[model samples]
Target: MEHSHTADWWKKSTVYQVYPKSFKDTTGSGEGDIRGLIEKLDYLQGLGIDIIWLQPVYVSPQNDNGYDVADYCEINPEYGTMADFDELAAEVRRRNMHLMLDIVVNHSSTEHRWFQEAKQSRNNPYRDYYIWKDPAPGGGVPNNWQSKFGGPAWQYDEATGQYFLTLFDKTQADLNWENPAVREEVVKLMTFWAEKGVSGFRLDVINLISKDQNFPDDDGSARPGDGRKFYTDGPRVHEYMKELNRRIFKPYNLVTVGEMSSTSLENCILYSNPEQNELSMTFNFHHLKVDYPNGQKWELMPYDFEQLKSLLSRWQTGMQEGCGWNALFFNNHDQPRALSRFTDDSEYRVESAKLLATTLHGLQGTPYVFQGEEIGLPNPKWNGIEEMRDVESHNIYRILQEQGKSPEEAFNIIRERSRDNSRTPMLWDSTPNAGFTSGTPWIKVDERYPEINVERQLHDPDSVYHHYKKLIGLRKKHQILIDGTFVRLDEAHPQVFAYSRVKGQEAVVVVSNFSKEQTVFQFADAFAEEWLEAGPAELLAGNTKQVPPLWKEMALSPFASYMWLIRRK
Candidate 1:
């Protein structure tokens, strides 16, 4: 196969995220692995995905699933051996698809030999690999810094009478990237993977890799005594990323993306600038955080269409030439189903799902399809908190309970916003455990699998799967959708979200109705003379009519959307 390095491949390509543990299980062990993924290569290719970003499958104790790595060079026995991974990589190459793996260098499992050796004594050679410090005079934590999952970020160890930093759970200790030896080890690990034919890496919590050495305590306001600033986008983040890129990523032609939590637009531009060899792109959470509560806990904060449109438009236009690419997505392993979160699930789930798909894929970025997203899967409804399996969910549930929140309130919050919402077993068929596993699954399958499995949708031409196929096809066939300049239309229109993609002579207009009520949008006069009836422009959903006098007003039903190709005479 000929290798293409024109930098245009990513611009025109589609990426799919595969959560290994939930994708498929071939061993009847109830856990998905690399071998299972190899078995589904044809399915992925058929879906038109150009890249597969697999979550962590490294050797670990399974504390934070696979995020806590025990050994960077070895594959977990439960997933498969190195031979199975090589086979998977070969299959990806055979299909001309890129294979990307998650890089969890920000932290390592406490069980990692390095961490174990560091914990043994302060004088150990590996002691500098992890962040360790002496306790303050009061013998309390190093500071009032709080873990993202909750509680103090520092955990005390009796052996050395010191504290170790863990931004997530105690079992996952943050690495001290300030040390040159640690940076060298990480670069070596990345090279080891790249040499095995891996094309890229999806960095995990990459922004948190650098920290404010001062370790200042929170002013008792932002986090209620928890210091988050010290841990977010610290002083040397870009420097560290540049070093990693120059040492390992650049030489291999690897496309790298960083999960930059709490990243600002300015910071994102710096991290993703094509000139800066830091990262190929960074996943921005600006739009995703709209519904989040003001403080820390998960609360019901409704979304406004105007605000969403503005946020997306700013990001789209701001990333014109020098800015790095965007990772466009609506749902992922940590997010709830897009159909449930962004649309009205009670009545217009299908239409809304289609609209969401069009809106994401039509943008100027690389679109990522999460497992089961193409079929418009709805969020699972857990009967009780005990049924949830995600660590974040369990931690939030405990925190709510301690705060004297009622069972109803706590359950409602989690049901609306749990990471487990996207972690449910993939609905492959109506069989036991959604055909994801022959035996019981590690996590419970969504109960609606009987009505929403892949088997049924694959047969229905009007299913969400087919709509995704059409949208992806449109993106590939039209240069306007891939590299066009985005222009927002009708900014203040409450019921309508309109945008036009223009690339010289080629232009495509997209209009979406976010509300359940019908909406009528009048096209601007500039498009009147050039507006030729381009067939019933692929209606994502609802009714449309071409009125006379060059006026095209569409009556979009609840959660409806449409795409029209405009041509000049």
Candidate 2:
């Protein structure tokens, strides 16, 4: 199917995600604030970023690191005041860059006014704003469902003697989408930001907004008994998304991406297909789970090369065939850094990081650059649980211990898979606190900041940051990168991830060696006869300074990556 979103600026743009807590701290508050981000607008623009995707800065009670928003309309004191936010929005526009806000409406922190008042009495007007149910006849939780973060999905309200659903942390009460009032509230909050010049909305766990009204128990089919099947891509999810688009996005002409949890490819296509009018793109975690043994995130294994290649190819082809868009990324606030997870941090950090950039950037999707990702940052080396501050990590660590894992064993897993791996402070310079804050940082900065800081990379032309910049720039220069039909090259190639994007006479070919050993790739019969003829092709980008010309048989060095643009002459 031919996609028609070519005219959309977002289609050709790159997004830079800034986790406010660890980005930078100008106020010595020990946490990053709006003003701190404002100070980095030039830095972002210099990196050729087209949009800035800022994580939630809404009022919260320090739960889920601001994902559990207590107030959607107000800026968190820890982040900054509304005035600071306004300055940020204005500064973003001044630089000709768009700002995308993270919208967390699936659940509200228990400290929110609606949830607080709802707890006051069952008859409170705000009671229906959240999901609540009567205790089971056996006087336990409402169902056998478990929270995504471990523990029962329902928390008994002592005052009301009823159970409330919390798909995540107990402090985060799932919003009741069955109530029109709640939906309206969400629209109002989004409109509030749109009115203030926010051009994009990154909806967190958006697919989970519509849950099954029946509140059924898990049948042991879904993994971990999370009851995700009942709510994930639920019966009314499409309707809810359509309603949201009609009320907020369509009117404002804003770009939107839905974070889909445990979602399927078919559901994602419907959610992001332009004709569906639901979302501009969707973020799915299937590829990121290649290392999850048996799809369990708490457990870890060496990433399956075959699975990673297959998943990427499937999503690329599936989304293209369905005219859907993807929000391409490897590292995000909730994920561990891709460098550490995919390649050896000691030997091939820079090359593999660039290899990953070229591999994903050449695909038909909008790429997102997590703050430290462009600088080739890897997972922090934590001494113990004390240095790791992620709430989920702490919870998982304790659970692993209860399951009979020794502290050392559990810590190793946590060290590798903890969300804190990506949440570490952005390394700006090698000075104290990695130049993130003058005061003691809320969390310890990664010890490798001295070598990986942006300052060091900025001056080096061969740095990973420059490689990302070149890859991003190519997206704008080559329309094939955005609108071309995706075709995976040598789908079963053991050590190399390769693909080609074709659009009429022009094609962008990308190849990356995912292994430390050298690998040779042979062009397919069709591609070799059509494009690999003895002709001149522009080498658009490569991880190494010296790259060989295109040929029928290509040899890729360890962690090597190259993107070539060819046209019928």
Top lDDT prediction, candidate number: 2
Cα lDDT tens digits for candidate 1, 20-110: 9999999999889889899889988887888899999999988788999999999999899999999999999999899999999999999
In model 1, the Cα lDDT at residue 343 comes to 85
Superposed by TM-score, candidate 2 places the C-alpha of residue 68 at a distance from the truth, in angstroms, of 1.1
For model 1, where is the 10-residue window of minimal lDDT?
541-550
Predictions in order: lDDT: 0.82, 0.90
Q: Write the per-residue lDDT of candidate 2 for residues 157-234, one digit (tens) a residue.
A: 999999999999989999999999999999999989999999989999999988888888888875556698898999
TM-score of each: 0.94, 0.98
Give me the displacement of residue 330 in model 1, in angstroms.
Answer: 0.9
In terms of TM-score, the best-performing candidate is: 2
List clash counts for every candidate, in order.
0, 0
Give the Å shift of residue 257 in candidate 2.
0.6
